[model samples]
Target: MTQQTTLHAAFAGHVAAALDALKAAGTLPAGLSRAAVAVEPPRDPAHGDLATNAAMVLAKPAGLNPRALAEALVTELAKIPSVTAAEIAGPGFINLRLNAAAWLDELRTIAALGNDYGRSTVGAGTTVNVEYVSANPTGPMHMGHCRGAVVGDALASLLEAAGHKVIREYYVNDAGAQVDVLARSVHVRYREALGENVGDIPEGLYPGEYLIPVGQDLAREFGDKYAAAPDSEWLALFRNRAVAAMLVMIKADLALLGIHHDLFSSEAELQAAGKPDEAEAWLRAHDLVYDGHLEAPKGKTPEDWEPVELPLFRSTKFGDDQDRPIKKSDGSWTYFGADLAYHFQKAQSADALVDIWGADHAGTVKRIKAAVAAMTGAEGKPTPFEVKLVQMVQLMKGGQPFKMSKRAGNFVTLADVVEMVGKDVVRFTMLTRKPDAQMDFDFDKVVEASKDNPVFYVQYAHARIRSTLRKAAGEGMAPSADHLELLGEEELGLIKLAAQFPRLIEAAAAAREPHRVAFYLYDLAAALHGYWNLGNDRPEKRFIVAQDINLTGARLYLATQIGQLIRNGLALLGVEAVEEM
Candidate 1:
């Protein structure tokens, strides 16, 4: 079903219809604005089940006071079959309470839709390119890359769930000074593999031991053939081999977290294809770039600073602090220039673009946004572009700082964390916090089978529900809606929480935040557990009441629906819901 037909959407439409009724009665102006009206769950459940700002949003335009408009709107809203009460609060806000039967119907919808209950058409199938975890192809991915990788993958999934055609992409930084260092490091290990005693790695080069295997492979194929050659003679050959091998390890690291990119765009390939040159010419034709000398950088000046003309993009016109240099004095493209070209090429196929970057690149957002605006301007239409800067994750074990990885030189590798805990834990924990906030991932806490561990807690709730269903099935007690009318407050409360999933998924996808799904799952699990504990004091509240088959069927239906909702939520986060934890 379309999002516009959901329960919440129906209420929003009711609000609009009420406004139109007021307009028909000439109680409100003909051109009253309803665009700002929002129908959503109130911040405090005690306020009401759902609240709307219809009166407050349109009062001034309608030439009526807020309370006056609210009073008029409530009359029409209360006429809705499911709306039992509509009350005007403190100034103008209208709070609504739907009958308990409304939530029961929502539970029926969940069972009918099953896994597709939360899917939405909010994105309208717009093509979006999500480029993330573009970690340099010089070594295995470290902990620093974990957050963005998970966030990007989850966001892509979320967008698709919201009906966006999303392309998961990884831009490989294969052409740069760093890859040269990787090649040199691999050459050192190659010499050692050829029976030459290579000393300690130099200070400026990569010192990771992960390259030892790559070196051994090279030696096995061509034993010391390039070991004694000049640096110029073997640099390109070694760089290509090293980059290819490192990418293999990188892809494997991503696999550990259940991530796979639909495309791996290479900077080297773009440069070789002269895309950067084309971007420079395009910007030049638009007068977006010009040969200019920049002033000394603020707060710090290099000792070798000198005035020299360079091809620069007028990023200052598009909200950047200063004009950005696109080409160096040597007529070579800068990193930003190559990145701009890549984005330009991406914009050709996708209607929107999103980049998941480390927080360190926060300073780079404006320049890239400026470049996107310039490139998309040529097409005579604005394309949506966003950069999500993911903060770092601090790893801990036993309450002490945990930081060391031979594969990544000095930092903890993503594979290391995934191996310590399973992929599901790693992914859910990464999404526990918003991407812009710094978080601590304690190894000990995530694996604990307690309420404090969100992933385990949510998984356990699903498992418990499944176990209850299995017990009922063994006794020939299948879920039946014959006694659905017997469900009470606790049952309806759980259903209300489950009903929010479709709305929550749409909002999270629009906001590009997957952590909302995590938070919602936590709340849903808590609601289920709360109702489950109620069975301790009130045995009649339990799912499998042997004495009353009808009640047992009803509670079992609720339990099965809750399990389905939890499973659907976990799927969005790329976490599996196990039948047994």
Candidate 2:
């Protein structure tokens, strides 16, 4: 299929053609790279409809002054029928102002493409595996894991929208000491379910009341079969069952926020397959692993520090602070050891890998990154990889910290928040800030009807458009493209803003930042609301005109397209574009 041409893309081709013309006419040098050439809207609308740094970006390499290059470029661009004016701006930036007909044509593009309007092929032929919300299978999902969950899921969808095959994955940390702790915690609850006074959750085990049901099921099933047995007789059974139960709860919690992963990999399964052993042998053969002793950790008293010989991966070779141990002194794999194998496994089927982790894992980012680089680069096709750390979210209400849920035992469960405010609000609110920045999820402000509330404001824009279209239809007027030329300056201005969606999607996908979608949607919504306000003072400007069916169809056409674009964007964020408030 031929790619649908967007306004930004069309003008980008024009700028490139202009440069090519300069080269062909012997006015400029040949073979200059156009990698840095970009077409985007001017920062201020008053500047122009669209601006390009083609002249400015090419001037230095082409050895011509920016202003001179811009002038020549403007002369070439002025030949295009759609470009009414092309002018040189500050330094060498060239800005183009198109006639209203150009934008009205783009509004037609929105109608032709509908849901496919903003889709881009920027990431075509690349497969990205996004691993996120790998919260340990020890307890219920909570606000602590919320930000990364929403960010990662939305990012996966954004990549898909940008034309990449995305694998939405979750790594189950059902291995090492943590799951064992979870198993024992369930055992304590099991005895309690069996009418034994297990007492107030002994230290060093999960104490969440969410485990009560799991323990009750186990008690009813086993009927004291392993209640008094030694740890060797029942540890594995309880561990497997407990992890499965916790995962069920975790999945349910994530579902409440509209999240579902395509794959949930198990650490224990990876180890049982001897993947870690396989990774070690290959790294050692490549000299990326060696037996070494780590220096005493920082802040440890010299008298308290002990050095032990262990097999360490040469992570320092790839920019880590130091070589890292791959195995404990007792010959068991370290968490980093298993993690390295897991990353290598993920690199097998993907062109790139992305991990969304909590800020608490900040300290481990480098070594794991180093391992991935070494492991994948060795195969002569280095895979692309990135780790995004989502910072903490403080839950607040009534101007202070919201109390934790007793059912969750301590923290505010994700389910608790979603139930209180609805799934759309929780997901949208989680994405209001960048993943790396700290944010507060305030119960009071998030649901407020004011424009300051991004979720409410953006959704209100879509709802208003739908209401307008419905009212117009009732009066026998419907959206049409027959009189699109009737759309005026204010209407064209809205199209100019809507026209940026294609560019925004590509840029956001390239940057791996999904929050940009949220920010852009809010701006578009603001433009819609601002245009609607203009109609309050001018009846002819309203979307519906009983006396002017042709003009009303044109205006309603504009509103319908705007609403469709909003729905397209909201879907990428896994949010709902409500037809009514």
Candidate 3:
């Protein structure tokens, strides 16, 4: 077991023993429920290290005042070996002070686990599918998709660290009208490359210099064969070729951001292969499909509405406001239909599913959940699916809003952001806020080496540890793991921060929020920085000394453990912890 597991186990054992003692003493009624009791860190450090709500939760049922029950429980808890002091405070909280030896022992466990210090088995081998960055293959990824990519990838890594069998997926919209536009766009560039003036891109067409390369490749391969052919003859081939080339470029761009997916499901391939029909069959088998016309959207003018008879999913049966159509008026499946098929595939394959989408799709969440519930007959029960909507990210430079427009053809791509601030800075900055909260990415501030820049602050903490280790090596006083027990208060504080790693991982994975890990790393880095500053005021507190090799070795061990934790935490977020900033 990891150090965090050991610590939590010990703490839980002590709490359980206290409850048992309360039972034996007859101060508490027999057969009183004990499952709701919880032990967690105190909100105020001065209260004690940890606090429990056993007395507060039991007071009304036990017919006793909360403080009286807390006082009685505190007396019972004082007998446990792991608890140094137990005090009652604040309505009914039982505060716990752990023995100093327990904190010291955690340092040894950190040395043993090293970089794997915070790994856990909470997921217990369940299969989970995380889908994100499903940007259409028609164009390169832009700044908007970067946040979802980083958040999803980091969440996947966090789940893996917590022992989930995770599969990262990308859904490609290769069967849409956008792909047709891309083919037409590439054809214009193809004609231009062949010395033909395809003047002024027509309406409803893409105009970007990036497509010029695709045109050149097509010209070199086909050699004027499709150059003069009719659109009906070559449109499919051209669209397929252009989409293939664009997807390669998109994959390279995602690679620059350190994102790799285990699977890429194509909409075109699924449609051509009758996957939607199979999904409809499954829905029919479950009595979820029907032939009906949707109610025209409310509060809209008649000209803005189009009503048609179509095959519909009985989504309203599962709490949706209205049933949704699976096929469009043209008898082709809508994007929503494809999405239903994709989720059906996921439900059949994985034990759980999570999707990260842009905030524009927030309205789609209810219908999708309703469809899932209707398909699985799990109404009013939790489904193994969740969708997280990522809010917009506004890019700024020097306190001014950066402008990007498709008409100008100068939109900032993900590659541009990666090239400007580097992948580590981009990933960490994108995750500094919750996924649902809006984030501002200031080009000037991220690259700055100040405490205001969280990425630099955390990286600086790791670099400072390396500096200490270098100084120790120069003085021939590098500490060994065996001497870590000689650490003092500051060193023990650093060790305590390291010991919180596994617990943080468990919490983050359970919450499905990678931003929490980013916040925790910043806090841990602050602890290290404060400890390092202490050495400047007290010479005896320095991590290295030429006169005492044993003391220096102990301090070095402590510093090394802190460095390992910073690196591990940053790694989980797909950020880099540099030895030198």
lDDT of each: 0.89, 0.92, 0.84
Give per-residue lDDT, candidate 2, residue 438: 90
Instruction: For candidate 2, give the lDDT of residue 300.
Output: 87
Query: Global CA lDDT of candidate 3, please?
Result: 0.84
Considering only N, C-alpha and C atoms within 3 Å, which residue pairs clash in candidate 2? none
Candidate 2, residue 451: how far the Cα is off, in Å: 1.0
* RMSD of every prediction: 2.5, 2.1, 3.4
Question: Which 10-residue window in model 2 sums to the lowest lDDT?
Answer: 1-10
Q: Write the per-residue lDDT of candidate 3 for residues 1-581, one digit (tens) a residue.
A: 34544465466667777777877888778888876776767778778777889999988888989999898888878877768889888899898887667776777677777777788787999988999999988778888789999999999999999989999999999998999999999999888888788898878887877888889888888888888899998899989999998889889999999999999999999899898898888887777888887887779777998778898988887778788888998989988898888787777777778999999999899888777666544454544788989998999988789764442154678887888789999999998899999889999889999999998999999999998888778866775866656777777667666666777787788778989999988999999899888879987787885677788888888888888888999999998888776
Model 3: per-residue Cα lDDT at residue 517: 90
- Candidate 2 residue-wise lDDT, 1-581, digit = tens: 12367887788888888989999998789899998999999999898999999989899999999999999999999999989989899899988899887888898888888999989887876999999999999998988999999999999999999999999999998888999998999999898999999878989998998889989999999988878889898899999999999899999999998899999999999999999999999999999999999998889887998889999999999999899999999989999999999999999999999999999899999999999999999757779899999999998887698886558776778888888999999888888899999998889999999999999999999999999988987888889999998888889889998999999998898889999999999999999999999889999888887899999999999999999999999999999999898
List the candidates' TM-scores in order. 0.94, 0.95, 0.90
Number of clashes recorded per candidate: 0, 0, 1
Query: Which of 1 and 2 is the better model by lDDT?
Result: 2
lDDT of 2: 0.92
Off by over 4 Å in 1: 1-5, 16-36, 58-72, 299-304, 378-381, 404-408
Quick one: ranking by TM-score, best first?
A: 2, 1, 3
